[model samples]
Target chain A: MRKKILIVDDVDINRDLLRAILEEDYTVVEADNGKKALEIIYSMKEELAAVLLDLIMPEMDGFQVLEELNRRREIIGRVPVLIISGEASVEVENKCLELGISDFIGKPFNNMVVKKRVRNVVNFFDSKNLLEEKVAEQTAILREANITLKAQAEQLKKRNQEIIDLLGTVVEYRNLESGEHIQRVKGYTKILAECFMREYPEYSLTQDKINIIVSASALHDIGKITIPDSILQKPGKLTKDEYEYMKSHTTKGCELLDAIKSEWDEEYKKVSYEIIRHHHERYDGRGYPDGLSGEAIPIPAQLVSVADVYDALVNERCYKDAYSPDEAFKMITEGQCGVFSPKLMECFRKVRGDFEGLAAR
Target chain B: MNLKECYASIGADYESVFLRMGSDSVICKFLFRYFDRNEYNGLEKAICEKRWKDAFIYAHNMKGFALNMSLTRLAGASSVLCEALRNGQPEDGVSGMLADVKSAYVITEKAVGNLERE
Candidate 1:
């Protein structure tokens, strides 16, 4: 598109000549007086690319226009200005130059010289404009890339949250509980598991290991799905056969996970297989499903076993009214010393408030 | 003439021009004129006789010439022939290669040659 060039000259003859010279290559707009020029300059500031100003005018002179242009520094500095005058005094030329006029055209100028100077100035302006356009294009491309990157990051965050939510949902679906019981149990188990691993670094509770523990904790009772709903949702006591059937859920969970071992990578198989198999195994020899004892079952599964039992005891279930937090704490603490490690119990006590809050929710 | 000798006369930069032609029409025309009518047919006969090594070298040089002239599809066909001959699969890619060479000849000899003479 052709750039708009404003002509500000009081003389009709001069404005006509300049317009004739520039109009074919440029879109020309005229203002006969400096006051009118300022009005045009301000009103069409966004559209005008350059200006040609005549120095001597009647009311508001070129000097006054230059003064007004300078006063609006931000608006005038960006627009290119060319000064045209019959006056050849050094003083006047110096003043125009000091006010940052782009170029000067002397009066009685040769038509060829006038055309050449204008063409050269316009060519320079064209090149400068091209460079600015390229920069703006690059900036827009960079902004688009940044926006895409931000959107992808948000998508990844939501995806991670959704996976966590899904894992919690799986546990809820198996037990027929509403809300995220698995999420709370998994979180609490993670805190206690890390503390237990720290107290005994022989187990190698590295950050990656901790993450796997937290992830695998959600599957601790996944075997419960295999138990019949009659036994699973039973309010009261279970017969020996029903109790034995219920106990087999842990082993069944492990076997089910084992069947899909070929499809998953080795790490996932190891963690999930261990969690479903050993979560119910007691620290002492007395626990059901497996006779495995202390420091034997995966620490994560053990931690989750403690947290799950605590949550179950403290929360109101269909069979029994909820126990007080104090009563539940007393049961876990006073019963079997070897059932849960002392260090883990300490961490559990520290975050007891969080568990209580989760239960309330 | 030794093609390498012609290149040496004009410095290393001269070789880049030939390198650019591959088996393209410009070099194809240059070679056609160089050997006259008997030459290209003679090379083709050698390939038919199962003189594998000679056919391989001819196809390799033709491949280079085709690419340099910006006749990309022609170069691609020649490239396949060159690879087949190099890998002792000359019979595998030969029919397709010969078809391409004939089409490129028609385009360059009729279209571009007519345009140039005008």
Candidate 2:
């Protein structure tokens, strides 16, 4: 199909001469002045391949048409405009080129030069527009792929946490412990962690860290799953040999964690290992397994230990009856269960009412 | 006179216009159509009325046509008249330049009329 070209000139002779030269290879369209030329340019914009604009005309002129094209930028870079003029000075030619014409063809224009300039400009713009469209298409596709990847990452993260909670629940059921024990420990852990966070900004107890600590708190007695049911569910007091075996549950849980170190994120694994192994450790260097003393016990374990001690006291077990909420709070504050860090004791006391509220629930 | 002789009589470049316009028959066709244009008359009227801008525009059109047709004398005279009437102010020599343009335009018109359209 022949590409359409617009010829804008005031003189019928000039327009005819160009049409005669160009009409053989192109579907030539003409306007005697700039006004009619502009109307045709706008109305036939999509169909036009190039414009052969004369610089001088009535009602509007080449420069005026270029000005309008500049204001509507979407059209300017599209259809190429070739200035056909007898403009004498370098100043006028430079001005036209600066105004965004593809090329300037001085009159008495040779047919070969006219045809070549028009064809080259049309082909150049065709390739440029095609490249732009391809880039835009690829950008949208990349954006869609990125969104899919992000959603997959979020789903994987949620499923990982669900499996961790499932493992903690399995341990709870196997030990003959109530399901609410793990949940209450988690609730109490959050309350105390948040209070500790506000009172001690030096610890950097951010909400994310608190969430990890709370989640890990559920797995504090996960080591108990390693103990035989005969010992775990004993109604009488544990003997010296059975108590020593029971204490190994903390180190035994760390062994289980070491096996899956590559599978879990470093932060979650680190906090879980701390809570599982050191929840039984005492701040006063008296409580066993590791005998970690003072601030030497990990903060995550300290927070969970206080929560575990409070939950264990308030809930009935095979060997012990449930303590009253008031008695449980008083016992923990009075160091009846285990000695904790002074700062941990302070945060624990601040949220004493919160602990009782969860125990009751 | 033949087309070549007609072009020669007006001091226009016959070979350049032939090369530019593509053929003698095409040239003859546009040459005759010149008589139908109003640029020269418009330039005359605008200059007589002292409408310098309109006169400049018309003179510019005249020079453009002369260049496209390879009409040397007309392009030279009209270009001078256009410069004289530029800046929307008529120079002292504009009337003289307009006479020169008129003489060149008349000669080209007479010369082009000598050639048959066929």
Candidate 3:
């Protein structure tokens, strides 16, 4: 590739002289003053590789032009500038260097020196372009790797979600719940989580987190698999020891998940285990094996806890009568039943009608 | 490396890229989300009971996560169990591999957790 050089000089003879020396090997562009040079530079962009600037030009001086070029360094990158001056001084030369001029050509210069200096800066321009080419190639490669990695991640996310769906179906079937119970709970949880997030946007819980909550909520009762079918599908209230055994389902669910921990993600692992282990926990510290109370229990568990109780109370079950929405709400919000956070209770009160609407769907 | 040094080495663009990559990396997200104290407790109980089928499932599941994280050795160990179970091999050498997997998970888990916190 032939690099195009732009020569900006007010003096016609000097411009002609420089162009005559450079034109054979290089494609030369001419500008009478700094302003004209800048116009060409802006329009030319990547094609113009170097500039032969005259220090004493009308309108915009070479130093002013240099400052402007420096300002646009990001777009221009490392283009070489060789200043052509008739009156040379050490201080002026030093100032040019400090201001990042590539080279200098003094007055009455040897024709060979002009050729050599132009060629030197042209070499600089070529090397810079080469380096930039390498960087662009590397960036392209990195971009391809990133895209591959992202696709792999997306595939895994889809597969994990499938596992969650399959597990939810399996557990619900084993527990003798309705086919749509787990699916409905998932839907309800999503709506509630979104509503909660909207009500508290300052927390910055992303939509991703909300989706996880919905997907993982389906597996809340997986520990019931570890319980005996007779106990799991029992039609009547259990004996004290049997209830104690059933209470161990939280730990049992955690154990079952642990068996698959090697395959699961830590976030899903935590949220899933908490949903299983602590969904039975009461906000007032009165429910379950651990009896973790209030915010002490993980928030995922609390969310599931409310969802679980509300659904269990309203939906027809093998051992219990389905309560009306009013009755269920009254029971959950009794002054001291030792269930649910007050703040969450307030949210439930606001959203129970919406919950019923979702359940009906 | 110290925080600033590691940050520098990764580039000023590191956080944006790291977070973008981490979210886009299933293994990283899985490690951060699923493998936790509760999982440890569950696996301990399952192993103590010698529930081989359950062990095989856990090991294989861990293998999936390890492979995704590019924790090759951990993935290899879990893979050993996964293959054993897939081929219906008895759980004879699983304990050794499980131990290797446990250590790897701990190290990666802590390192990743620190990065996330930072």
Task: Choose the strongest candidate by DockQ.
Answer: 2
Residue-by-residue lDDT tens digits, candidate 1, A1-361: 7878899876554576567567777799999889999999999887777888877665687889999899988655667788876545687788898998878875534445555677777667667767877998999999999999999866764554454445546667666554466766776777677666667687777877777667767777777777878998899988999999988978987776666523344564577677777777777756767778777766766787787788778778877888887788778876542376666677677767776776676
Candidate 3 lDDT over A1-361, as tens digits, reads 7779899986554566677668877899999888998898888867877898877654787888888888988534667888976436798899888878888876535555688778987787788889989999999999999999999888877877877778788887785456577877777677667777777677566788878888999888888777887886788998998899888888887888777844656676677777888888888789886988877987677777777777888888777889987787788888333578776777777788888897667
Error of 3 at B23 (Å): 71
Instruction: List model 2 lDDT by residue over A83-149, tens digit each.
Output: 9988847999999888888899987688778888888999998888789889989999999999999
User: lDDT of model 3 at residue A209?
Assistant: 83
* lDDT of each residue in B45-106, candidate 2, tens digit only: 99999988889888887888788788999989998998888789888988889899989988
The fraction of correct interface contacts reproduced by each prediction comes to 0.00, 0.88, 0.00
Show where candidate 3 strays beyond 4 Å: A1-107, A199-204, A335-337, B1-118
- Candidate DockQ scores, in order: 0.00, 0.67, 0.00
Candidate 1 displacement at residue B57 in angstroms? 88
| Residue pairs in collision within model 2 | none
The CAPRI category of model 3 is incorrect
Say which docking band candidate 1 falls in.
Answer: incorrect
Find the 10 residues in a row with the least total lDDT in model 1 chain B: B109-118
User: Could you give me the TM-score of model 3 versus the true structure?
Assistant: 0.58
Report the candidate with higher TM-score, 1 versus 3: 3
Compared to the true structure, candidate 1 yields what TM-score?
Answer: 0.44
Q: Candidate 1 — what's its lDDT? A: 0.67
